[model samples]
Target: MMKRYTLMVAGPLVLLGCAGPLTPRDTQQAIRQEVAQAAQPQPAPHAMTDAQAQAALLPPLKLELPKGAAEPAEPRFDLAVNGAPAQDVFMAIVSGTRYSMLVHPEVAGTISANLRNVTVPEAMSAIRELYGYDYTMDGKRIVVRPLTPQTRIFKVNYLAGARVGSSDTRVISGSVSASGTGGASGTTGSGSSQTSLETSKINTTLNSDFWGELKVALETIVGESGKVILSPQSGVVVVRTTPRTMRDVEHFLKATASAVERQVMLEAKILEVQLNDGYQTGINWSVLHNGQHKYSSGANTGNFDLLTGAVSGSLADALGSGLPAAAGTTSGIFGLAFQTKSFAALINFLETQGSVHVLSSPRIAALNNQQAVLKVGTDDFFVTNVSTTSNTGGAGTTTTPSVTLQPFFSGIALDITPQIDEKGRITLHIRPSVSVVTEKIKNIDAGQAGKLTLPLASSAVSETDSVVQVEDGRIVAIGGMMKQSFDDSANRVPGLGRVPLLGYFFGNTSQSSKKSELVILIKPTVIDSQADWQADAEATQARLDKLERQPQTP
Candidate 1:
């Protein structure tokens, strides 16, 4: 079984509620009542002082004090005696377990004279200031009480005023003891008495320059005291009084310094990055650059599927395979795994060859707030057919001819338009044009954008084929074309139009043909009409202002 410990800290003893707000007459009455009660003569508790009462309510932690417990020549606090002759005064320094109390006494001819003249209200106020509590007077006794049950140990040291003619006067006196769960540490009465003089000197110095020289002093002390333990949970250093070897002390100090430095650096870096961008901006490069490639190529007749596999594999190896593959190769009814490893390798080679440029840039950085457009060029369509007929009269006659229109290429131009929204979303629109065919014809003139339209039933043309739509504002489309021809007339060589050499037995003939072709054009456009970067800028400023007004905590 594991042992568990929980530290429950008590709150300050200051009471939130007070006697109802007193009127001027009520205040006078209360003061008179207190003074009348203090007028009665009462015996002091055995060797106990008002300082002791205040210290009793605090925690059981020893306070560090100043060096040399000797009294100063002159006190700095006010002193009084029996409501007259405020001359004989002494300064006292008092310390107890977990508390320190100070008192300056006004000397009277006797101790009774001093006690009788002390005003209860003044004493109560002084006690409250030093110990953070309240007090009341009963008859001749001034009863000092904590405003609340909770008490926090505090270390205090102050100088007081001196008496006019007393060198043996006590300048200050105070005491301290464990306030809660006094346990074994409380039993050691001399624990408070055995105050290390050096520790007190260090504490005094620490109070004046807490943020500067104190850090250096802490480092030095930790180095000298090997028994110091750094508590991560409490964010504090616990020092034991036991002696240790110099080497051990140095080791402990070094470890503590390293831990502190690391924590500070980490926190500073987090704050800096947060100011510029979001937390995700700090992601490791390995994740972002994985599976990126530059270039790939293969023979025109080579299997497209195999080439795709090789390229993908190379990419996978170069960028690493932590992520799933985004591209693949396909056979008629089957597919192959084409990871980025192969693709990356090919891209690397091509980059070295200067054939392509691979950015290898962070995807999020490139696309997080950017927009781009892509254009796919135009396409053309064409179709042609030819036939011949001949006639013979008296003697045999024959004719042979051929007409052909070859399709060099067929394509449709696609223009993609892109638009970006406030949240970095993209939309695309596309426009397509008809396919064009260029070939030699038996009887057509050159340098002409030939117009040929085939029969509607035989042509691959439709309204839907003219345009393509993309989810992200991208588009593609195709155009239509058709061609046909026929012979019009044929006759025997009995006519005058047929000469002897050109027409056997004077034969006459004529033929007519029809041709059609389709041309496709693609145009893309981008629109940023709806975007309002000015509004975004204003919102960002407002967010920053709100953050600035928030309260900060340590």
Candidate 2:
């Protein structure tokens, strides 16, 4: 007998060897057997539909591990599926693992998955993450369902100052008419009299959009049962819709209100300088040709007259003493009459010192208190290079690039609109556009307006927009322009003043310098109707009268 050797170790041992290659037919049979074996991996206790999964649930698997023995981890899956229902993908992922997955009927969608050696738990987590599905684990079973859509309520305001009732609702008023024929008792001429009362009822609501315009645009998305509530008196618009639809409604409201609202007041301070401490400012200004021509007009105040520091009047009327109004120019704010005439007064004051210029006048396009449009005209110009390619002679043939001048006119136009809320806060939308007028090379036969102009221009627009929220009655100041003035003069004895180099000693030199800042202050308020402006005027007059009646203290 040959000598036998025994080997002892902490574990068992086995012999390893490489297997010989099999024929194509044999390989096919082998693959089929492997797939058949895998088909029953992690077989469920019983087959169940999504609806029945909850009722015929998988019983908890009670497992016990020996002391000092390692617990088996979740099985990994190498699954790949193409254009399969989500349920099938989940089934593939859960096969061969300790986990069982149940997909609710609401989770209806197709899935294409490529998983590489991923654990069952990891694969389940990824499936939920990618699809935004919600899942919960019960023992070794996982339940999944699609998230339901959420609902939200949004609030906005329009037509502020109207008296909306406690319920924030309004009723429409209709007219009632009464017509009767006269009955003759004796020798009475037939006659008819009609009486009408201006009071009736209807169902209607108004907003900056006027008659709930956004409602129609959102109906398709919000569905037939969605609700839009309008409170005219409180200026509040309440929208109750799904989260996705609410977003669309919000976008619609911003656009619709921006197009038609206007009513904004700009309080501007225009000042000039005389000396570092002593200043002379009595000026009124105007602009022509879209802010190109700017000039000032005022009265003469000799010797830099001293002024009383006590300023109690409006900024417009502070310097009204020596300046005369320009012809065709009105004295009130934006051509509107209020009790206080301080705006013109301020213009009068600015003209006395130096040349005053109005770079831009506030332009109002729409005046809806709930929404408004404020604009300032700005213009710019530039040139751009053009390049073109063509197949002229033959296949790869090309011509030399030609050179030409192209004139382009670009201007800045700011369109600002605000969405007012119930608390008087505003979500301001500012659209700043660069309007381009491309100069088109035209024939001489074009009209005079086009002929005299080089490269006739066609209008186009490019815009950038943003939103900023601010409270009502707040002042926003825009400032950039600064001016510096230097005044130097000398009074000399008549004959000695002409002496060139030696005249320095005969004359006195006086020099003074002054600087000023240009500022524009914008204040927005909600006015449902013109009556609000009238109320403002009456209130101003009352205050002024009250001041005048009070005795002054020396």
Candidate 3:
């Protein structure tokens, strides 16, 4: 007998050894399989490590640690006593302000296989036997109290695999934890840990495919009736629904993944560019003449015939020589001859100042029952202001000269068409209706003749301008003196005081009854020149005639 002695081993033991090395081909094959499986897809992928997940999921980005910075060794936890070689085990370490994790499928697989048919308490017991730690669930949180005085709390969510059939089963677990302090200065924390073991095949549905279907629906609906405004700075499309209702939101989401898509497309098709520019024209007129005398008095005071002859001679000279040739043509008159010296002086002043553009012209109609049309043109002529004055010599010898005066004033509208040629220019055409009232005051001195006359008592003038763009609009009852005068005695008189102490009064009077009123009627479209419309037509005909007269090329 050769000392036949044998020793018996006790319980289960794990021999610590290096993992088997994987060949390059084997590693490549495994990686390809993983890539193919992941490409099949389900939910959006979670692209973060365990540590990164915890940092992102945590409320604040800070952690607290003990006074001195000390790094702890990696934690090692046991999974089973007699576990299979290919089992998987997952571990998380919390040290100071840092959290890390390690996974070992060999250990995890061993534990899963041994506890396949075990109860929850038995599983817990097995875990304690291997790692010397205990775990308990408090609602959704898992509480792991170490033997040390430091207590740590962990928030966890777990999902157990569903039973598919009698022959197939799967299991999974996940947990997250925090320890030390609260708030931003809290100590190290670990995200939920997860474990899964399955004996059945899984059928997954791809979410990308579902989203693709939704996007197609959205594009169809938005193509029909949708309007979008987008910000140039940010490429964000703000979405709005048709009729802006809850139903529209639902419709949009079901059809399109986002509203921004519609906005971007709409913004690309808008036109961006500005068009405004033109000229204006206007016309005015005044008439000055002498009325015949009613009766004659004395020879020394001068015969009515002699006075009338003097007045007529003076008027003929002034109207014939003083007035411009253009005025005669427009007024349709060979000349305007008044039978009064006062009227001649008035015409002289007006013609010298170019204020006699339309005074008593051939263009003016006769004072007959038939209406006469006066055609005004804006081609080379424009009227700005009009005025008149009359003075009569005292009867026989002059004590103080008897005077009668009238003045017409207005603003001239100039042609701005050259400045802006695109849009039509503005032009003003005026037609005046005149009514005169003369009153004679008595109590005349021996050398004086009693007389009171408001020359431009009441007048109706119509002004139309294309530049004003107001149609059928007429400025009526337009009457005022371009120049006015006041005697030094005006201050001595109460009612006449403060009547523009000196110089001309260039504005309208304050008296409502005496003031001018205008009624403007606007047309949908603008006209070039209301005053010159007919004149322009005639001018155009004349130009065509002239052109026809010129020799044509053979």
Instruction: Count clashing pairs, candidate 2.
Output: 27
Where does candidate 2 stray beyond 4 Å?
1-419, 427-470, 478-481, 500-502, 508-510, 537-554
How are the candidates ranked when ordered by TM-score, highest leading?
Answer: 2, 1, 3
Q: What is residue 73's positional error in candidate 1, in angstroms?
A: 73
Q: Candidate 1, residues 403-455: lDDT per residue as tens digits?
A: 44543333322222233344432322222222333433344432473654342
lDDT by residue (294-367, candidate 2, tens digit) is 22222111111112112122222434533224312322211111112244443444445444555344434334
Which rank order by lDDT, best down to worst? 2, 1, 3
List per-prediction Cα lDDT, in the order shown.
0.29, 0.47, 0.29
How many clashes in each structure? 81, 27, 40
Model 1 deviation from native, Cα RMSD in Å: 40.3
- Candidate 1 vs. true structure, TM-score: 0.16
| TM-scores, each model vs. reference | 0.16, 0.26, 0.12
lDDT of 1 at 143: 34
Predicted candidate 3 versus true structure: per-residue lDDT over 1-554, tens digit per residue: 33433222211222224446789657756765554444442443766787888987885856876587566643343334354322122231122213332322222223332445443345445655555343454442334433221222111111112112111111223334432322233222222323343332322121223233433554454444543333323323343333223234345543332221211000000000010111001112223312331111110110011112221222224344433332222311111212222323433433433433332222121111112233223222222222222323344322233333443323222111101113332122222222223333333243454343332333222222111111111111121212222333211334344357532233223321111212121111222333333443454455445665789777
Q: Name the weakest run of 10 consecutive residues (lDDT summed) in model 3.
A: 264-273
